[model samples]
Target: MSSSEQPVGEVQVHPQPAPPGSGPWARFVTWAGQDTIEDYSLRYAPKSFRKWSPMACAITALGGIAYLADYSIGASIAVSHGSASAVVAIIVAAVTIFLTGIPIAYYAAKYNIDMDLLTRGAGFGYFGSTLTSLIYASFCFIFFALEGSIMAQAMKLALHIPLALGYVLGSLIIIPLVLYGMTALAKFQVWTQPLWLVLFVAPIVFIATADPKGFNGFLTWAGDGGTERVTAIGVGAGAGVALSLIAQIGEQVDYLRFMPEKSETPPWRWWSAVLAAGPGWVILGAAKQICGAFLAFYVAGKVGFTAATEPIQQFLGGFGSVLHNDTVALAVATIMVLLSQVKINVTNAYSGSLSWSNFFSRVLHIHPGRVVWLGLHIAIALALMLGNMFAVLNTILGFYSNVAIAWIGAIVADLVINKPLLKLSPSYVEFKRAYLYSINPVGFVSMMVGSFFSILAFYNVFGDFMAAWSPYLALALAFFLSPVICILTKGKYYLVRPNPIREEIEKEPLWAGQTLLDIVDQKRYELPDMVHDCPFHGGTISSLTCTLTKCHDLCKTSAYIDSVTTATLRNAAEPQPTT
Candidate 1:
């Protein structure tokens, strides 16, 4: 090799070429493994592909929150707990979601990794995060089923379709949109956002102007018994239902992972996109919940308590007030429902694919690509919809909130307390499998202990008051227990070996415009500040190749280095480095 093509790092063995296949099935699988389908599902997102502007990423992330389940959740809480308690519960949930989401979102965007990867590095080890992957995947399919049920309701109302067939159709429609991943999702979200906003706002605006007295009635409306009042139990139960959405940050970070490097982007734009798309989702969510509560009150006298809790019925009543013609109102409401469900379900499917990909890749030791998992995710969700999961929405969400909050609470404690405050964990996220222990007791034990006690509380093992307060118990226990466990264990399980690349970057940062050559591809590419070390070959490789080559066991050991290349770069201003 010439002086300009010197290898940056030495290795005992170079990366061998992937085995080739030329048959039709091989071609199809190759097509399925394209960037759009793979989407770095089991690895870090490289800077080369994260070209979208901050605002575009933010808008795409925000689009997923348009699901009408918020309306249903809000209405159910209000009807069960009364408006006064619902108000307090919704605010508490929203504030908690916003606060917990900040560190998770910031880390995902900064590191160009998804929520699963964030979890791995935050506190959970390589295998420890697999459990969280399951939890997050369950959240996706559950919400997908819930959102699809709402769409099915619209189809039943508008076209007289049976709920079973509507369930199949609703699940199938999202498949094609999600198959293309963020490439299609970004444009689809941006294009549909304006129309969705208008439809979303119209009902609230109409009710305020046309039925001004409705607000007064809503304020004093008692719940199911006509004797329900705000109480500690009522507020706890209501907040638990609302807190089920804590897992939503995973979906948001799936899109936020495509955010451009912060060093290249303007500071104001970067922070704005991260915050707005990340935790800021709850602002709109809380507003929608409040709207759901008010609209439920508006329509309850006409539609009865049960029907008032359904989004289709809620929007239909709101539209009926605005458009005097019942047919026009139903048509508009159905369109709104269809649009809302499509936007959010695509995200649910997309995020679920990522979660399942991470999960199976670790457990099964097989790589079938994300598109395959997308199909499996939709299938699971379709089954739930056909099973009428929506009928017991409150029951399911209330039970689920305990486990989900415990998982998130552990992650938050690791990010906010262990990593930053206690300084027990590593500063950077180290998700690659080779460097991590099978399980880290700090987060894993904390989550399990929290889930166990909270779930018992949810089952009324303690008392009615504890049953209502299960999610809060989960959150508090998980959050505080992580730091305590880390201190007790001395944080040794976090990484099996130190990362040299991160250490080098901390000591002296790499030049932003540096380039490195990949020996496997025999092509030069701009070097990322951090690169993964190939544990099998003991060669330094670009992080991009780590994903592209499907070399699943790379350690991300350290900075690219060979004695010659290091000295060359130190002396020459524009030295060429190879991996």
Candidate 2:
């Protein structure tokens, strides 16, 4: 028998000590690190913590897409570039988002990791993913400000509050709710879903019933372009703006990581939850955009084209059709706007916290906890809200789409093509800092090259046509370049060392319900729950290593092996008595 296959009875088990430091600051940090609140921001989410049912996790994820920003985006696109162009643009963007989101969402749920962690193993490597983390964080705060702006507009209409003060109030209200993380968010989203659905659907139903002719008029509306025919530039520009939402898959995976393991849940239930909550979010999002375009057309005569893009006005006009009383309609409209914005902004804030946590932890090597970053994220969003970011929303989103799609495209290529087809990257994700290179050229170089040329195209360096089509250019380059670069580099940068735990698993397979001892912390962990690589040692460790003891340095090359297998190997090696 090998030394590693020694008898289980011969091995000694030692209990690990508590985390260092008992100061007030340390205590506060400890408090913030609570599993119920922090939700494993910096590491793999173990099976023990992913207790929520797949359906429940899916609902929570879907609830985040309830932002009223889609209404504004759709309305703006339709008004700027005719209904025909808007329809094509919305469909194209939705299809791209749905297809790209599938591989990312499936990998996240299967691996029990977030986007940042997934990026590390996919191709970007350890530090290369930090840039994507910044991109994702920017997505969260940008949308938070946008959603907060909508809420402020509703407050201004309902209570006659000033927009500046309303922005502050709107941003502040979500702080308390998000401070507790997934524990608070899951319950809150599920509880409010029924009401949000009713409010969301009622206005569309009422508008269709009361104004049948208005729907037809919306179809013929030529917009500011004064042409119903779909031009290439119009489709491209509108799609660019809509594609800014591609990063939303990051937010979806944040909740999908909490889904119960596939082995634990029924196969049908598992896939259904993943698809429904993952890429399926864009289905409702696209419908909402089309509905917003129609609503904008319905109210365009009463309010000017510019004012029609505002969600507050759209809902007010929708409710006015149903409720004859102007005061009641205004009140109901304001309530719906508030409800929608609140649901989405909380998600924005929560996902932003996780992104910021990942970014700064790698950069500064110090994590004050996700709650501190939560405050930072909200502050940045508040600043944007006060700056009237909603006024130039299309311009900002159009430009941002170039970089956002490049990041997502590179990830998708690595997941769908490189790992599966070329077999350059590993089949499994390796996110531990100990095993990953600081950066990998396959994904990092592809994103950089894609973003550089796309930005130039966006600025009209090539031509007006190329400028409008820059986002697609970015997507294609990143997607194709990832595999080419992987081939050129030969995948040497993917891992610093072979994963010893995985090597051991290949030698002797572990089954469910089996118990294994963690050699470092000396704790017993069940089969699948103990399979995670230790962030410090780059070998198998107890899932609770960092959380239970907060000790990273003490473990060196630790691994989990089955006690029964060790005993059998030991018995076979010993001399048989008088045989």
lDDT, candidate 2, 301-388, per-residue tens: 8998988999999988998887989899999999899989989999999999999988877776666677778989999999999899
Error in Å for residue 530 of model 1: 7.2
lDDT, each prediction: 0.84, 0.83
lDDT of 1 by residue, 1-579 (tens): 543564342111112223577764454366444666677777667666776999999999999999999999999989988888888889999999999999999999988889988998888898899999999999999999999999999999899999999999999999889888889999999999999999999998998888766678575577685334577888899999999999999999999998987777899999999999999999999999999988898888899999899898999999888798999999999999999999999999999999998887777665556777888899999999988998899999999999999999999999988988888899878876656777998999889999999999999999999999999999999999999999998899998766665655445434323455555544444433234456554556554344344454534324433443475667897756888
Cα RMSDs, all models: 5.8, 6.5
TM-score of each: 0.89, 0.87
Clashes of 1: 4
Displacement of the residue 140 alpha carbon in candidate 1, Å: 0.3
Candidate 2 vs. true structure, TM-score: 0.87
Model 1 weakest 10-residue run by lDDT: 9-18
Clashing pairs in 1: 8-578, 500-558, 501-558, 501-559
